[model samples]
Target: MDVSQVFDLNGKGAVEALALVEAALQEQRRDEEVKLWFKFDPPQPGGGETLFQPVGRRLRDAIKHGHAVRAMPAQGGGWIVRLAAKVR
Candidate 1:
């Protein structure tokens, strides 16, 4: 089955981002395939890395662990995060 959803975290921060991503990854694990989006383009020129590093780190970890695919830059200021379900 294929699933699709969007997480519009425009003004929100890394904490919320991580939570949403984790939820998506968990949900994806229940299916064979899934598609998801997260609107957190980040990198507000000169913005402190500490402020956005968590989100980046979380995504990186997910990719490293094979829990998700990758975050692609969208036309809008966001990320089209593609996730893959974990194998049981």
Candidate 2:
């Protein structure tokens, strides 16, 4: 499923957005990673790490123990994030 359709948790606040991400993780497929793309308004300098770190942490914490979460800036605008369980 597309991340937007599965996790469409658009909100005005960070806390609300994080909550949506957490909820989405619970419903995600266990065998495959979930990828998400976010676009920032006006974009940010230096990839917007400072703005996205907390959100990334929330995603990591929501996943299964030992699962991995990846977040990085996209070339043109916002961020790309992926969450997946670790291989045993």
* Highest-TM-score candidate: 1
* C-alpha positional error of residue 80 in candidate 1 after TM-score superposition, expressed in Å: 1.5
lDDT of 1 by residue, 1-88 (tens): 1227777766666676678767766666545555666665556768655324565577778789887787655555555666776567
Q: How many residue pairs clash in each candidate?
A: 0, 0
lDDT by residue (tens digit), candidate 2, 1-87: 245333333333567666665665555555667676654443356734333555556645644354446656555444566767544
- Lowest-scoring 10 consecutive residues by lDDT in candidate 1? 47-56
Q: Candidate 1: where is the Cα deviation over 4 Å?
A: 1-3, 41-53
Give residue 63's lDDT in candidate 1 (0 to 100): 81
